[model samples]
Target: MPKNIYFIALCLLCIWGCRESASKAGANKKDSINKVVQDAAHEIAGNFSDQRSLRFSANRLDSFFTRYDSLRTFQKDLTTFYTERNYAFAWYSDSGLTEQASHLYVRLENLPEEGLNLVLPYKHTLDSLINAANTQTLEQKSETELLLTSLYFFFAQRVWAGLEESATQKIDWLMPRKKLSYSALLDSVLKQGNTANVKEPVYRQYNLLKEYLKKYKAIPASSTTISLPGNKPIRPGDTSPEIVKLRKKLFLLGDLTNAGDTSSDTYDSTLLTAVKRFQRRHGLSEDGIAGAGLIRELNIPVPQLIEKIMVNMERNRWLPTDVRGRYLAVNIPEFVLHAYYDDSLLWNMNVVVGKDVNKTVIFAGSISQVVFSPYWNVPASILKKEILPGIQKNPNYLEKNHMEWNGPDVRQKPGPWNSLGQVKFLFPNSHSIYLHDTPSKSLFQESKRAFSHGCIRVANPKFLAQYILRDDAAWTTDRINKAMASGKEQYVAVKDPIPVYITYFTAWVDRQGDLNFREDIYKRDAQLSSLLMKR
Candidate 1:
C-alpha cells in the first residue's frame, strides 16, 4: 500500500474509536438516570402501599419526581409515569445508577413522612420519569440528581419555617433569660410522627410562649382583702398637745374656736375640726357637725383607699396601648380634670362627673372639635323622661330657664341660667357626652359632685377656654368674654383639635406618687377585683 493510503486508514480508525467511546458514555449516563427513576418509583409505591413505611417513602418519592424532568433521558420516564401507572421500572437505569441514587437519598433525609401526603397526586409523573431514565447519559443523570437534591432541600426548609411559626406563639412580656421544659411537650406531640422534633432552636423561638403559659397558670383566682382601723374620738379636757395638733390638721381655721385653749367652747373646736377634715377627705360636706355623711366618711379605713388605687392602676394597663398623648384625664374619684401633655400633667381642676344613675363611661377618643357656647344636645333618655315631663307640668319652663324649643331640640341661650356654663370645652364622645361648663356652680361646692346627666361639669370655664384658645390668633379671653357677653348664642371654632379621653379611674398615683383613691361610685372596681381573683 502507498503511504497516503496508510495515513488515511489510521485517521479512519481513530474516528471509529472516538465514536465507540462516545456511545459507551451515553449508555452509562442513560443507565444512571434509569436507576434514579426506579428508586423514586419504589419510594412512591412503598409510601402508598405500606402503612408503616408509607409516609417517609411518599415524601422521598415526591421530592424525586419534582426534579425528575431535569435528568437526561429521564424525561421519557417522567412523561410515561404521568401517562401510565407503571411503578417498578419507573426509576430504572443501565449504568452509573448509584450516583443518581445518592442524590435521592439526600433529598429524603430529615423530611417527615407526614409531608408526603401533599405530593401523592403527582405519582404518575414520578413513575414515568423513573422508567425513562434507563437511556440517559452519565453526565445527564448526575446533573438531574444534583438538581433534584437542591430543590428538595429548599422546599424542606420552607416547610420547617412554616411549621415553627404556627407552633410558636409570641408573648410580649416574657423574660428572655428564662428556660422552659418543652421536651416533654414535644415528645407528646411527635408520637404520631405528624410533627418535627422539638429541636434546641424551636425551644428558643417558643420561650416566650412557654413563659406566658407558666405565668398565666400561676396567677391566683382570688384577691385578699384587709380591714381598716376604727376611728378614735377626741374628748374635751383631754387636750394633749398631740391631740391639739391632730385637731388643727383635721379642721379648717374657721371651724376652730379658742385655738390656744381646749376648754372654752360648747362644741370642742378640735373635735369639730377633726370631723370637718374627715368629712372633706371622704367626699362629704366639710361641716363641723358629725352628721351621718361625715361619720360615714371617717369610718372608711386608709388601707381600703390604697387597695382602690392599686386596682385602678391595673385597669389602666388594660386600656389600649395607643392612648392619646394630649388628652383629658378625668379622675372621676377626685372629681377633677387634668389635661395631659407628653404624659405629664399640664393643669388640673375640680370637675363634676355624671350622676350615679347616669355614670360616665370609661372610653377613649379624640376631641374632634370644640363648640363654644354650644347647645346641650340633651340625651334622648333625659329629653323624654326628665325635660318632657317638666315641660308638660309648666309650659313656660323653657322661657323661664332661657331654653328655646326648636322642634325636638332644646337650645339654651348664653347666660348664667344656661345649663351649660359661660363657656363649654367641647370634646365630643360617642356616649353623647362632652366636658362643658355648667350653670350649676353650687354643685361644684358639694364635696361629692356626681350630679350631671352624663356630661362633665367644669368649675372654671373661662380658664379652660383661655388654655385651649392660646394657640388661636382669633380666640382670646377677651374674644371669648365678648362672645358670651353678646348674649346671643355663639360658636367659637377651635384652631387645633385636642383629643379627649373620658376615663373612669377611682385610683391612681398622684404626681407625688401618693396613691389616691376615689369612691367607686359605679362599683366597677369591685367587679374587676372579683374578676382578677377568678384569674
Candidate 2:
C-alpha cells in the first residue's frame, strides 16, 4: 500500500478497536444494573415461577398486614397500590428482583441520614430472602411483598409526611400539618421507579440542608471547645493562634469561599469578613469577634449540626403545601417574622417572642383587626406575678403604669409608654397571642430577643402596620399614624383576613440558599431532638 493508504488503514483499525471496547463497557454497565435485581432474587430463593408474579391478592393483604401492625393505618392505601397492578409482583422477576426495588431497598437502608429511628421493613428476613439462603414459599413471598410495601409507606410517612397529627400536637407543633397522599405517592413510585417524586412532598429546605448534611458529615467531630484564655472575645486585629483554626472552620462551613492566607496568625479583615458571615448566618451579632459565644457555636460538632438539619427537615414536613396568599410566619427560634404576599416573601423583620416560661405557641390564625392605640389586657398570671408586686410596692402603681381597672381585670392605656406600643394586630385564638408593637424598640437590636408574655412583639411595627393596611384605601399612612397617636382605643377590621402562622424552627435554609442555625431561645430543640433520636 501507498503511505497515505497505510495511514488510512491504521486509523480504521484503531476506530474499530475503540468501538468494540465501548460495546463491552455498555454491556458491563447493563449487567451490573440487572445484577442488583438478580442478586436480590437469588438471596430470597423461592418456589418461584419463570415469570415474576405476585402470589397474593388485595384480600390477602389484611392477613399479611397483621404482621406489621404499624402499617395498619396505611393498609387501605397499600391495598390500593397493590390492587392497581392486580396484585402483580412489584420487586421481582424471573431473572431477579426489579432494579426499582433495589433502589428502594438502598433508599430505605439510608434513612438514618434522613434521621429516622424506626426499624426497617423486613429487617432480618431481607438478607436471607435476597441471598436465597431461606426458601420463600408462595405464602412467604406474599407476606414479604406486603411487608416491603408496608416499609415503603413507613418511609413516606415518617421521612416525608412526618409523624401522626397526635404526635405532632404532643410536641406543640400546631401549624396545619401538610397532608400527603401516600396511596397516590405509592402508585406513582411503583410505576415510575426513581423518577417519582419520593422527596417531592418535602420542603425545599430539606433538600438544601441535605447537601450541607453530607458536607458536615465529611468533617470530623471536634471534641474540644475552641477555648480562649481568660474567656475573652477575639476582637478584630487581635493575633491569636486560634485564627488559623477559625479560618479552616469557617471554610468548611462555606462562610469563607477561600480560607485566605493562614500562614499569618493575625485576625485580618479577610477572616473577619468570614467570621461576620458565620455570625450573620447563625443570627448572631456581626461584631467581628470570635468571642466565647462564637467559639461555643464553632465547637458544636458537625454531626450535631446535621441532626439539627434533619430535625428541622421533619418540622418543615408539618408546614402547609401552599403558603401563596398573604400571611405572616414568625419563626420563634429565629426571632423573625416573615411577611408573604402571593406566596412570595415580601420582607422579614426581627421580633420578640415569648420566653421559655411562656412559650409562643406554634399555631395558625387570621389577622382580622389592627387595633390602634390598643389597651394591654393584663393576663391573670402576669397580674399575680408582676402587677400585684408593683401595686404592693407603690400605692399608685395602677396610675403610674397608666393602667385602670376594667371590671376585675386591669389594662394599660395605649401610648408610647404602653407595653403593646401604638398598634396591635389581632388574630383571635384561644391563646390570645397576637403581633403587636412594643414601647421598647431597643430590644430589637439584641441578637437574642425572646422577652414576651406568649405574644410576638414586632420590631418594625409601623412597617408591619403599613404592609397590613396597604390594601385598604380607608387606612392611609397619615390616617394610621393619627389613629395611633390619638391614644384612644380603635379597631379596624381587615376585609381580607391574613393568615398568621407562628412556627418554632431552630434551623432553616435562607433565601440565598445558605443554611441558618438559630439559637433555640425557648429551649424546645432539646426535647424535640430527644424525640427524634429515640431509636
Candidate 3:
C-alpha cells in the first residue's frame, strides 16, 4: 500500500473514535440535566412523578432558576426595608407589605412548593413587615403605637398578656404614694412601647400590678371598744341625765332641751325619736334599743366608717364589668338574696348560707330551671355522713323525713318536713349548688344564720318562685301550689336563663348612702380589706 493512503486511513479511524466519544458524553449530560429538572419539579409540586414528558419541548431548569433568583432578590429587599432606622418611612413602606407577607407565609406553610407560586406575593409582603418590626425603636411610643406593638409581639410570640399584666401590677406597687388613677396609670404604662422588648415598661407594669394585688390584701383593723358615760341607767320617758349628756356629746340637739321640756322625762320623746333616727342611719335594726348592738353602731368613729366604705368601693372596681344587666345576687355575709334588674333592686329576702364547716362559695352562673315539688337528690357527702348514720341508728328516721334509699342514692320526696321546701331555684354552676327554700323556718328568724350544706336556703321561697315564674303565663302562684300539693317531682324550665351571682360583701352603701355592715360568715372581707390597704 502507498504511505499517503495509510495516513489517510488512520486519520479516518481517529475521527470516528472522537465522534463516538462525543456522542456518549452528550447523552450523559442530557441524563444529568433531566435528573435536576425532575428533582426541581418534585420540590415544586411536593410529590413524586415521572411527568417530565409533559414539558418535552420546554426548558424547566431555566424557569426554576428565574423563580429562585426572584425570591432571593425579594428577601434581600425586605431585609433592607426592615433595618431602616426612619420610623415613618419603615412603617409606611412595610406595614401593608408585611400583612400580605404574613398571609402568604400562612398559606405557604400548609402548601407544597407548587402552591408557593400562588402566595408568593403574600410571602414577600409578610417578610418585609417582619423585617421592619425587627428594626423598630425601643424609645417611648404613643399609647396607640405601644398597644399595636404589644399586639404584634403577642401574635409574633415575642410577648404574652400575662407578662404585660404583671408589668402593670409592678408599676402600681412602686408608686405607693402616687395617687394616679388606674385608668391614667394604665394609659401611661401602655404608652411606653412593647414592655417585652423595653425593660423599663415591663418593670413598670409589673410593679403596678403587684401594688394593686398588695393593696387588695391589706385590710385595716378596727377597734371594737365602745365608751359610754359611766354606764348610767336610763328611764323611758325621762330623758335620763346621761341621755342629756350624750346628746351634748353627739351635738344632736344643740341646747339639749326643746320648748317646754326642762324636765328630763318630758324630753324623752325627742331623745327616743333621735335615737331611732340614729339607729336607722347607722344600719342597725332600728329597734331603738340602746343595748350592745346599738351602742356598737353609735361608737363606730366617722373616719373609720369612711375608710371601710373606700375599701369596699375599691373592691367593686376589681369586679368584672360584665356584672351589669339583670342578675340574682346572694350576699353571703349579709345572708340575703337580692335580684337586680338594670341595677335596681328587684327582690331582697333573708337567706341561710352554709355553716363554717360547709361554706357557700362565691361564683356566677345562669338560672336554668325551677323545680316545684322536686325530690331532693341528696349529695353523697351529706347522705353518707349525715343521713345514712341517722337512719342506721333509727330505723324509722328515713320514713319520718320522707326519705328513701335506692341503692346508694337517697331520694327525698316533697313534704312539709322536706329539707328543701316547696320551691327550688336551679342555677347551673360548677359548684353543683342551688338556692332553695328550707323547711326550717326558725333558722330565718336568727340574726345571723349559716345552716345549710353549701347551698343557699331562702326564707320566703314561695315569693321568689312567684317572681321568677311571672313570665310564664300558665305557671301562676295557685298552679305552683297545686303542683307542690301533688307531691310529685316536677321541673319547670325557664325560657330565658337569668344571670345569678353568689357573692360576699361585708360592707356596702344603701340607697340612702347609709353604710351597712353584715356579719362576714366567710371572713372574706377582712382578708380583702387587708389586701386593699397593702396597695
Candidate 2 regions exceeding 4 Å error are: 1-55, 66-76, 83-85, 91-99, 127-144, 195-199
- TM-score attained by model 2: 0.83
Give a tens-digit lDDT track for model 3, residues 208-301: 3333333323423332233444564333454445554445433321222353333343335566666666555444555555666666655565
Ranking by TM-score: 2, 3, 1
TM-score of predicted model 3?
0.55
Name the better of 1 and 3 by TM-score: 3
Alpha carbon lDDT at 216, candidate 2: 72
Considering summed lDDT, which 10 consecutive residues are worst modelled in model 1? 167-176
What are the lDDT figures for the candidates, one per model? Answer: 0.50, 0.78, 0.53
Residues 1-535 of candidate 2: C-alpha lDDT, one tens digit per residue: 6554555566556556666565677987656545754554443332133322544666787676676675687788777776665677666565556555667777777876675656775677755565561466776666666666777777788878876788778888877878888877765675454623454677667777777777777777863346785778887788877767777778778887864564556888888888998998998899888888889899888877877877787787777765677888888988999988765788999999898898999999999999999999999999999998999999899999899999999999888899999999998999889999998999999999889888999988888888888899988999988998899999999988889888888887788888899877766676677776673
TM-score, every prediction: 0.48, 0.83, 0.55
- Residues 89-177 of candidate 1 have per-residue lDDT tens digits of 21223333333333333334422221211332234543444455676554345334433433333333322222222121121111112
Question: Which of the two, 2 or 3, has more TM-score?
Answer: 2
- In terms of TM-score, which candidate is strongest? 2
